[model samples]
Target chain A: MLEDKNPQKTKLEQLGEFGLIKHLTKDFALQQKSTIKGIGDDAAVLDFKDNKAVVSTDLLIEGVHFDLSYMPLKHLGYKAVMVNLSDIYAMNATATQITVSIAVSNRFPLEAIEEFYSGVALAAEIYKVDLVGGDTTTSTKGMLISITAIGEAKDEELAYRNGAKPNDLLVVTGDLGAAYCGLQVLEREKEVFKVNPNSQPDLSEYTYVVERQLKPEARRDIKELLKSLEVQPTSMIDISDGLSSEILHLCEESQVGCNLYEDKIPLDPTVIAACEEFNIDSTLVALSGGEDYELLFTIDQKDFLKIKGNPNLTVIGHMTDKNEGAHLVARNNSKIPITAQGWNSFS
Target chain B: MLEDKNPQKTKLEQLGEFGLIKHLTKDFALQQKSTIKGIGDDAAVLDFKDNKAVVSTDLLIEGVHFDLSYMPLKHLGYKAVMVNLSDIYAMNATATQITVSIAVSNRFPLEAIEEFYSGVALAAEIYKVDLVGGDTTTSTKGMLISITAIGEAKDEELAYRNGAKPNDLLVVTGDLGAAYCGLQVLEREKEVFKVNPNSQPDLSEYTYVVERQLKPEARRDIKELLKSLEVQPTSMIDISDGLSSEILHLCEESQVGCNLYEDKIPLDPTVIAACEEFNIDSTLVALSGGEDYELLFTIDQKDFLKIKGNPNLTVIGHMTDKNEGAHLVARNNSKIPITAQGWNSFS
Candidate 1:
C-alpha cells in the first residue's frame, strides 16, 4: 500500500553516483559546532576538544531485518538512525554527528531513495545531530544500511556496564514490549492483506503498538532527566535485544547478579491488549521481545528516593552479590533463572 | 581453488551473534592509548584530548565489490579495511581506530568468518589501529561489509581537497593503474578456468598485477614521509577513482583548474607490459583505471626542490586559473579536457 504509483520514475544511473549523492544530501545543513567539515571531503573533521568521543555502528539488511511488504522505506531509514543513536545514548553521551552509508539494488528508483533520506533528514533534525559523511553505492540484490554514530561526553560523566555494585536499584525508562507487539500486529495484518488485497481491516485498536514498531524513538531525554534529578546510573544499557538479554549483559560485565520482579516489568496498555488477543504471555514478550529502544540502568540506593513516583522511571529490582546468580522473582513468590532468549538472527 | 574442502565445517548458528563477535575479535589487543574502551560495550570510548578526529566510512556488497569465486574472504576483509583507511590517510591524519560490521548468508561457515577476521586483525596490527567495535548479523543472500575508520590530527596538520593554489604543483605517490590492470589479468584467468576446469594456468607473469589488485595497501607512510621532508601538501585526495577523476575533485573543491602531463603520469613496468599484452593504451589505463589507493596532492612551487627526483614521488601537473579548465596535455602537445570516467556501481 505504501509503494508509489507515480509514473515519473527517475532511474538512478542517469545521474551517476556523485550526482545522486549531491542531489540527495544537498539540504542537510550541519548543526553541531564540533563538525569542522561535513560531507564533500575525503573524511569529516570533528573537533571534540576536551570531551571523550563514543562510537557505535550497526548494519541492517533488507530481507533479514525488515519486510517491505509492511514496512515503509521512510520508517526503515529513521529506524536505522535510531538503532545507532541508541548505543551512543546508552553511554550517557550527547550525540553530535552521524555517518550513513547505503548499498541498494537498481530496482529502487531515485524517488524511492529520496523517500528514505527524507526520514533520515527528519531524524537528524529532530535529534540535533549533524550528517558528517557517508558512501552511496549499488548492491547486487536488496538494500543494506550501515550507520555510525559519534557522540561526546566528559570522562567523569560517562557510565559503564562494569560500575554496577551490589544493592544498586535497577531502573527502567518508559514502557517495554510495545515494539515487539507492534511487529506482531503488522505481521498479522500482512497475512490478512495477502489473502485479500482489497480488504480494508480496521486497525484503530493497534495504533499505539503499530506506531511504536514503525517509528520508535531513542531515549535522548533520559540523560538530561537524570542530571536534573541529581542521579547518576552506575551501569546502563539500551534494551535492543530484549530486557533479559541486556540485563544478563549488565550482570556479566559488572560481575554481579540481579533479581528482576516479574510484576514490575512495564507494559503499555495496547501491548497488554494485543498479548491477550494474540494468546501469548505478556511477560515473555517483555523479556524476550527486543527493539524497545528504552534505557535500562542501575542507580545507587541513595538515589532511589530522588526518582520515587516519577512516571517515566520505574524501580524494577536490585543488584545482588555475584554468588546469588541472576533470576526473576515471580509474583507467586518463586524464583526462576534468567537466560538469554532474545532474538538471534543466525537462528 | 581457494574454497575449503575440509570435512568439518562449523555452522555460524552454533555460536550466535554475540558469541561470534567475541570469538572473532578476542585476540585484537588495544594498541592506541586514545582507545579508552574497545569492543564489548554499547559504544567504544575514545579520548582524542586536544586533537581533531577524522571519520570515513564505506560499504561493500559481494557481487558489486567482489566475486567470491575468485576473491577469498581474507583478502576481501583486508581490502575493505584498506578502502576506509585510504580516506583517512588522504586527510593526512593518523588512523587510530576502526569499526567493522558484516552481514553474511548461512552458506558461510564459522571457519569462513574466522578467515575474514584474521585479515582484519592483520590489518589492525600492521597499521597500529584499534579494533574498537563492530556488528555481525545474518543476511538473506550473499555477504556485505561496512567499515568506518577514525583518525586524529591537529587542526593545522590536516589536509583538505579545497586548499590548492594556482601555482601549486600536482604530485602523485607510487605508480598508478597497476590494480586495475591486475583486475584485468584475473578476469582473463577466470575465463580460462571456465573453459577448462582441469587447466593449471601459470600466473607467474601476472603476479605483480594480480597481487596489486588483491592485496593493495593504503599509503599510511605518506603522512610521515611528507613531514620528514618538510613538504606539506596544499591539497590532497586518494587516487581510488582514477587520477583524472581525483584531479577533477581537487579542481572543483579548490576552485582551480589543472594541466596534467601525459608523459609525467607514473606507470610501473609490469603495468605497461600488461597494457601492451591486453592491447590497451597505457595512458588511458592510467587516466581512467582506479583502485590505486595512492596519494594525489598539490604542493607549493617553493617546496618543489624538496621532492624533486624522489623515487617515490612524481610531479605530474600544475594548477591554473579556474577559467583555464582541467585538461590533459598529451605527449603530442594537444590539450584534452579531463572528465570522470571512474567506476560508478549503478552503471
Candidate 2:
C-alpha cells in the first residue's frame, strides 16, 4: 500500500525531468558486458555479437493491472520487471538488459517514485540485468509502467511456442493457483479495511499466497536446470494468463490439441486450503488463476525420464492430434473443454 | 481529433486480447531480415549478428502529451512511432524493429484502435521497420502509449552525445520551431471550438506548421545523407526537448561550451509568419520551443565545405572550450546564457 514512508514529500515538478531521472537512476550500475552504454545517452547501445537477441515488452496500468491500496510500490515495481523477464525465460534465453518507462501523475511524490525505482534496482541486481534506457513523463491520471526486456540465446537452444509436436509431454514448473488465491486474500482484506478503517486483519496465515501475489519471482533458473539435465523443450511459454489460456495459446500456435489431466495439475497445500475455505473448485482455480510466473513447456517423450522424478517439474498433459481438440481429462473420468476463462484486461 | 469516423463501435472486450492483437497486426509483414520471429510468441527473436544494437523507449500519456480534442488518433499513433524512431536515428543507426504497448480505457472502440494501428502500420512500412511485438492492456483513465525501437549499426558509424570537441561545427537538419508553433495553433483552435462548437476555423494558412505537428516525420534519411557526403557526426541528438535543452545536453556530455548564433537558428517562413502573427520572439521560439524532431549534430570543421550551402543542413554554432560556457550570441552582439526553458512535462 502507498503508506507514506518519508515525512518530507518532494514535489516532482521541483526536480524537473532531467533532475528526477538522474536522481532515480544514479545508483544503478551496469552489470552486463553486452551493455555498451546505459543511461545518459539518446539510446542505450548493446553488442550481442553472435548470440541471437530476444525481446519482450509489457504495459501495466494502475487500477486495471494493480491496486495501490493493497499493493506496495516496491513490490509492484519488482513484479513488473519479473513479468517481462518471465517472457524472456520462456524463450529459453538469458535476460541481460531492460528498459523501464513510467508515467505518473502529480499525486505521486518524488519519494514514491524513488521507492518504485529502488524495487526495480533490487530486481536488476538480483537478476544481473543492466538498466539500459527509459523515458519518464507525467500522466494525467494514475500511473503506467512499460518494461522491455532484452535477452540472448544461441540459435539451437531457443524455444518457441509453435514448436510443440504431437505426443510431446507437457510439463509445468512449481505449482499453480497460488497467486490467484493470493489476490483473493488481498481483495478480501481490502474490503474488510474499507468497511472499518481501524481494523487490522492478521495476514500471517495467508503468507505464501500473499507473497505469491505481491513478490512472485520469475523462473529464471529453469533454463540452466533443463540444460544441465540435457533436456531440451520442444515448446515453452510462461504461465501468466492462467493454465487454460496459456495452454490454448500453445495449442493454437502449434496447431495441436492437448489432453491436460486434472489430477496432474500441481497445487500447493496452501493454495488448496485457500480454495477450500473460499468455497471455490481447486481445478477451476488452477486452470483460471493467473500470474503464477512459472514455466510451462513440452518435452519430447524420450527426454521425459530426465525430468520424471524432478520435484520442481510435473508432467501435466500431453500434446494430441489437431482433431482431438483441447480438453481436460477430469479426475472423475469426464472430459471437459478447455477455454480461455483466464484474466482478460478488457473484461 | 478523436472524431467519430465509424458509426459501428465494436467493444474491445468482444475480441479479447489475442483476437484484438491478431486482428490489428494481421496486415503487418515483417520486412527486416534480422527479425527471426514476430508476434504470437513469448518473445520476439532477432539476429543482428555482428552489428551493434541500439534501443530507445518512449512513453506518451494522453492529455499530458497530446490533446485529443484537435489531435487525431491516427496522427498520435504515427507520431508516437516517429518519436521512438527519432531517438534511434539520433544514434546514427538504422531502425529495424519496434514493440508498441498501449493501455486504453473502455471508452475507445475497436475501430478507433484499428485507426491508430493503421497509422502505426504506415509508419512501419515507410521506415522499413518490422512491428515485432507489443502488449495491449486496459487503462483506468486515458490512453498511454509506450514504444521501444530497435536499431542496428556498425561500431564505427555510431555516434554518441559525448563525442564532440572544441571547434566542431554544430549542424542541424531542416528547420526548427515549426512543431511547437503547430501545437500553439492546435491549442488555439481547440479553445475556439470549446466556446462555439459549430465554429470551423480555417487551418489552410497554417498547413506547414499543422502538418509538422500532426504528421511529423523522423529524419530517417539524414544518416544516409551524411554517409553520402563522407561526413560523420562528432556528437548527435534529436530535437525533442527544444534546441536549448538539447544544446545543453550536448555541451554537458561533451564537456565543451557552445557559441550558438541567434541569427543562424533555422526557422521556416511559416514559423516566422506565425511568430509575427502571435507576437512572440522568433529567436526564443526556435530556441525554447520543443518537438522539432530534427537531427542536431556536431561535425569536424574540415567537413564544413561539404555541408556548406546545403539547403537541408545548417551550421548554426561551433563548440568552444569548456571555460567559455554555453552561450547564445544575439543579433545585437549581446551574449546571453542559454538555459533549458523547454517543455517540462512535470510542470
Question: Over the stretch A1-347, how does candidate 2's per-residue lDDT look in tens digits?
Answer: 34434557888889899888899999999999999999888899999999999999999998888889988999999999999999999999999999999998878988889989989999999999999989889998888999999999999999999999999999999999999999999999989988999998898999999999999999999999999999999999999999999999999999999999999999999999999999999988889899999999999999988998999999999999989999999999899999988788898
**Candidate 2 residues B1-347, lDDT tens each?**
34345667788999988888899999999999999999889899999999999999999988888877777888888999999999999999999999998888888899889988988999999999999999998998888899999999999999999999999999999999999899889889888988999998999999999999899999999999999999999999999989999999999999999999999999999999999998899888888888999999999999999998889999999999999999999999899999988778898
lDDT per model vs. reference: 0.92, 0.93
- Clash pairs (backbone) in predicted model 1: none
The TM-scores, one per candidate, come to 0.99, 0.98
Second chain TM-score for model 1: 0.98
lDDT of 1 by residue, B16-87 (tens): 999999999999999999999999989999999999999999998888888887788898889989988999
Q: Interface Cα RMSD for all candidates? A: 0.6, 0.6
lDDT of 2 at B4: 41
Tell me how far the alpha carbon of residue A24 in candidate 1 is from the true structure, in angstroms, after superposition. Answer: 1.0
In candidate 1, clashing pairs total 0
Candidate 2 chain A: 10-residue stretch with minimal lDDT? A1-10
Which residue ranges in model 2 land beyond 4 Å of their true spot?
A: A1-7, B1-7
